[model samples]
Target chain A: MELLKQRINKDGDIKEGNIVKVDSFLNHQIDVELLNEIGKEFKSRFSLEKIDKILTIEASGIAIAVIVAQYFNVPVVFAKKTDSKNLDKDTYESKVYSYTKDKTYTIRVSKKYLNKGENILILDDFLAKGKAAEGLIDIINQSNSNLIGVGIVIEKGFQNGGKNLRDKGIKLESLAIVDSIENGKIIFR
Target chain B: MELLKQRINKDGDIKEGNIVKVDSFLNHQIDVELLNEIGKEFKSRFSLEKIDKILTIEASGIAIAVIVAQYFNVPVVFAKKTDSKNLDKDTYESKVYSYTKDKTYTIRVSKKYLNKGENILILDDFLAKGKAAEGLIDIINQSNSNLIGVGIVIEKGFQNGGKNLRDKGIKLESLAIVDSIENGKIIFR
Candidate 1:
């Protein structure tokens, strides 16, 4: 976690409206080496839980989930943001409101992929308002799967997403939590 | 490659309009173990070349590219399908037409990630018409990057995408080439 926090400080871009862009190494262009480290850290953090599968929302989360899944020795199921013809007709769906895009989109996972009573750990890159995380959790619940925890690479602590999930007693582990940004400098918790 | 072919035969769903859905292991729901095998196979296929970075598109390709990057010990850079504020203004862009969606969309990669003269290997989940692969190649060319080759997990040999890339003298390696599907059976080349 310390390593991730340091990397964020060194490479993360602090912008207005609490936008922390770690795209240089985290999202757009990925650092597989660092992702492996993140995998190990998540493994250590969730060593006790029975994680049958890792679930994530597509685009950025796919990279982190797939890498982290290597350590867990579990398969990953990503919720597709768009309705593609390739996707299964029978799916568990949830609506996510993306503030960045200023619109709502549906995220879905095939009913065949997620089964009942399976222990699931949700992993993602950023946790801002928790809309995406909430959407994933909703799908997991609909499938009657057990929620083990949520592991995030970077959490915007300034936002209420982390607090709300914690309040609901969800086991949320964020490697780096940026509490605030001042003069284009990231302040981590 | 035999393992991948076997997986496709066992779990791949052959639908109308020449759709082969291997979402169980390759894309939607991912088997990390199988992906590691894919990574090893790609490394062996492109063993003679010097791969500086692995380039791919978002959603499904991110998972494969990240896993494949481990074998090459290189970073993976994925082109963004949708424009997000997180992406840089300076980018290499290319337009791709999607037959499934019946629309064309732009894919962009940050100018910072892809450098001139860098050797890039484009990896993707599927190659039907090769529109996505062509778009990626265009971006690589715009950046003045050297495209080492294009690697596809499954190439619809019935389509002309594979032929076109091969005709262009590109080192395109498709682990499993489906020549045709007959009576709900996949014929591999």
Candidate 2:
């Protein structure tokens, strides 16, 4: 966790409205080695739970989830943001609000993936308003699966995302939680 | 490659609109072990190229690219479908038409990740229309990078994607190229 916060401070960029861009490593051009480290950290933190699968949203979360899946030794299921012709009809759907894009999109997972009573660990790159995580949780809950916990790489703590999930008694663990972003300054919690 | 085609014959669903859904293992719910085999197959196919980096588009492509990267022992740079606050402004953008969704979307990669003249191997889950591969090629061209070849898991040979790429003299290796889909039978070329 200290290593993550250090990496964030070293490479993260802060913008207006508490936005932190770690694209140089995390999302766009992935650092697989660093992700391995983050994966190990998540494994160490959530070792107590029995994680059957790792679920994440498409586009960005897939890489993080795949790396984390290596540690958990479980399959990775990514909820697609857009329905493609290739996607199956029998799917679990959930609506998500994107704070960055300022849009609400539906995330979908094949019903065949998440089975009943299976334990799932949700992982993603960023948690701003908790919409993405909430949507994933919604899909996992609909499948009657056990929610182990949520693991995030970078969290906007100033936003109510971390608080909202905690309010619901969810065990949310973030590697680096940003307390505030003021005038391009990043303060971590 | 045989394993992938075998997987398609076994688990791939032949739906209307000439669609084949491998969500059971390839796209939605990923089998990491199988993906590892796929990575090895890709490595064998593109054995001649000095692949410095693995480039792919997000969502489904991310999983295949990452699994393939392990075989290449290189970093994977996935193009971002939706530009979020986390995405860097200095990006390489390409427009791709999704025949599956009947829409066009932009894929962006941070400028920092892809350097000029870097040998790149584009990886994707499916090669239907080759629009996505062309878009990625366009981006890599714009970045002044070297595109060694494209590695696709499945190709809808009934469609013109494989032929189109071949006509352009682009080296494309698809694990399984389906020539026809009739009466729930998938004929391979």
RMSD of each: 0.8, 1.8
Poorly placed runs, candidate 2 (over 4 Å): A182-185
Residue B117's lDDT within candidate 1 is 97
Off by over 4 Å in 1: none
TM for every model, in the order presented, reads: 0.99, 0.94
Model 1 residue A147 CA deviation in Å: 0.6
lDDT of 1 at A173: 97
B48-144 in candidate 1: lDDT tens per residue? 9999999999889999999999999999999998987667889999999988767899999999999999999999999999999999999999999
lDDT tens readout by residue for model 1, A1-115: 9999889888888777889888989999899999999999999999999999999999899999999999999999999998887888999999999988788999999999999
Give the native contact fraction of candidate 1: 0.87
| TM-score, cand. 1 | 0.99
